[model samples]
Target: MANRFLAGYHAAFNQYGIWLSVPGVDVTASGPAANFLLRPDFKCEQIIISGRVAVAAGFNVDVMLPITVPTKRPYVQFGVAQSGVGQYPHDLSMIGTTAQIECIGGCLFRSDRLTFSNSNASGFTFYYDYLVFQRGIN
Candidate 1:
């Protein structure tokens, strides 16, 4: 498929490009692998994967991706979202939750997965929304 550029000022000034899946095509996961296979013609220099997961305290959560990244180390950004008394997104001044990518002693990333862990032992479940950006995809 051809790459489509954004219209208007951004396309003219920045040349921002976007890719869309072809119509009538199925990219869903199949078989034992359970990974969504990209179209053979799909190509891009960068891809962003975003999702939300609930992580239990003192436990690790692994998220599997549909694409195999070019490098084992990709840029990751994440944040915890909670709603309750004295918690974030509800109480603005509270520092109630903390999380981190387990890179030091845990699996941070593989070619197709990302692992996240938190140090909070309050027995509270944290809902984390993360974005994984990988460049050099072709």
Candidate 2:
């Protein structure tokens, strides 16, 4: 049984070694900004920013980032989800309530701040998660 297990382990190691020895296959999990693939045109610094904001009804708020945005208009991929009892981008008149939440702009990114606009007459807490990619600079 020990010999059989040794043989299986050896076979698995050989397969993994062959896969790792491939030219463009990278599986190094070195750092936060490490590229797991060998794509030359896909090397860019990225930062994940996430937060929650409570906006008053019919008001807008600007949330500051911990790090400065690399450019005036960097590539910001973001998502915002409503947490409170409100329907976003749709009128809640069918439910007999006028509380409709509107994201004024999908996601606005400035140099070092993110503007969140809530156009609802009822307050809501928004949870946002985004990835900021550094472009045009190595």
Cα-based RMSD of candidate 2: 13.6
Candidate 1 residue-wise lDDT, 24-84, digit = tens: 3322311121222332223443445776777677788999966655434456766664433
Q: State in Å the error of residue 95, model 2.
A: 18
Best lDDT goes to which candidate? 1
| Cα-based lDDT at residue 5, candidate 2 | 12
lDDT (Cα) of model 1: 0.48
Q: Model 2: residues >4 Å from true position, as ranges?
A: 1-45, 69-72, 84-106, 135-138
Please give the distance, in angstroms, between residue 44's alpha carbon in candidate 1 and its true position after superposition: 11
- 11-85: candidate 2 lDDT, tens digit per residue: 322211101212332332222223223221234543335545555556667877665534334466655556443
- Which pairs of residues clash in candidate 1, taking residues 3 or more apart in a chain or in different chains? none
